[model samples]
Target: MRTRGTGDACATYNQFSLGADYAVSKRTDFYLVAAYQHASGDQRDTNADGTNGGLGEATASIGSYGNQSNTNSQVIVALGIRHRF
Candidate 1:
C-alpha cells in the first residue's frame, strides 16, 4: 500500500498478490500468479515548481507493469511452465 498527494487531493492505493508453483518432474514445473490493485481519492497534478495544479482521478496499476488502468481498479493473472535441460 502507498499514498500520494495531500489533503482532499490525496490518492491511496491498496494492492494484493498471490503466487503458486508445482513441480511436475525433475526438470519441469508449472506456475501461476495473480495481482490486484485498487485506488481511492483524488490525485492532484503538480506544476514544475512542485505546486498543486489540476485535479485528477486515482488509477490502479498491478505491480510494476507500468500500465495504469483508466478506472480505479486493476487485476492481472499469469500462468506459465518452466523446463530445464
Candidate 2:
C-alpha cells in the first residue's frame, strides 16, 4: 500500500510518562522521568526516494518526533536536576 502523505496513513501512536521531583536543601531539585511510545497501523515513513509515502515514503513522522519509527514502539528514560536562585 502507498499513501500520498501522512494524512493518508492510518498510523497511530500512544505515549505515557511519569515524573517526580525532590527538593534538596531548598536550593535545587532532582528529577527523574520515564516515557514510552507505541505506534500502530500503516505508518507513513520517509521513503528512500524522499517522497511522502508509506513505510517507504514520507519525510516526517506522524507525531512530533523527527522521523517515523521503524519499529512499532519506542521508549525513553530521562533524569535531570534543576536549580533556581
Candidate 3:
C-alpha cells in the first residue's frame, strides 16, 4: 500500500484475503479466492482493491481476470486443468 500524499498520510485502511485450492485429479485442479479492502480518505477515485470508490468508501478485487467488486467485498473462483506433457 502507498500513502495518498508525499507526507505520511494514510489514505487506505484494513484489508484481508483468503484462498483455497483442490485437485480433482493428478492433472486437474480448482481454486477459489476472495478478498476485502477498506478505504477512508481517497483512493484516487478508486478503491484500495481496484474497485470503484463509490462515495469514497471500501471495496474489493478479483483475480487476474481484470474484474472487480461492485461493493466493499468480492469473491473470485477459478477452475483449471494442468498436464505434465
Candidate 4:
C-alpha cells in the first residue's frame, strides 16, 4: 500500500514493507514479501532556516527526510533460499 499528502507548501510520501519465509524442503526454502506506504505533508526545517536553531535541520521535504525526497516510492521482492540446516 502507498499514501501521499500535501499541505500549504509541504508534501509527504511514505512506504512500509513486510516479508515471510517458507520451507519447501530440509535444505530448500521460499520467501514472499508485501509492502505498504504512507505520505505526510512537506516538512520545514525550523532549525535550518536559522529560526528554530535546533540540533538537526527541519524537514523541508515530506516523506521521510534528506535523500528520500518528499515525493518517494517503494518496492519489494522475494526470492528462494537454500540451507543445510
Better of 2 and 3 by lDDT: 2
| CA lDDT for candidate 2 | 0.60
The residue ranges of model 4 lying beyond 4 angstroms of the native Cα positions read 1-16, 44-70
The candidate 4 region of ten consecutive residues with least summed lDDT is 54-63
| Superposition-based RMSD of candidate 3 using all C-alpha atoms, in angstroms | 6.3
What does the lDDT come to for candidate 3?
0.52
Q: If both were scored by TM-score, which would come out higher, candidate 1 or candidate 2?
A: 1
State the lDDT of candidate 4 residue by residue for 1-85, as single tens digits. 3344444434444556677888888787878776544445444445545774323212323233334333334343546575775
lDDT for model 1: 0.85
Candidate 1 residue-wise lDDT, 1-85, digit = tens: 5655578778888888899999999999999999888898888766999888888888886777888799999999999999999
Error of 4 at 65 (Å): 15
In order, the Cα lDDT scores of the candidates are 0.85, 0.60, 0.52, 0.48
List model 3 lDDT by residue over 1-85, tens digit each: 3223322333444455676778877866777765555444433455678875444443444435576555655555544555544
Better of 3 and 4 by TM-score: 3
TM-score of predicted structure 4: 0.40
**Sort by TM-score, best first: what order?**
1, 2, 3, 4
Q: Go through the candidates in order and give the clash count of each.
A: 0, 5, 0, 11
| Between candidates 2 and 4, the lDDT winner | 2
Q: What is the TM-score of each candidate against the true structure?
A: 0.76, 0.64, 0.47, 0.40
- Those runs of model 1 whose alpha carbons end farther than 4 Å from true positions after fitting are 1-9, 45-53
Clashing pairs in 2: 45-57, 47-56, 52-58, 53-57, 53-58
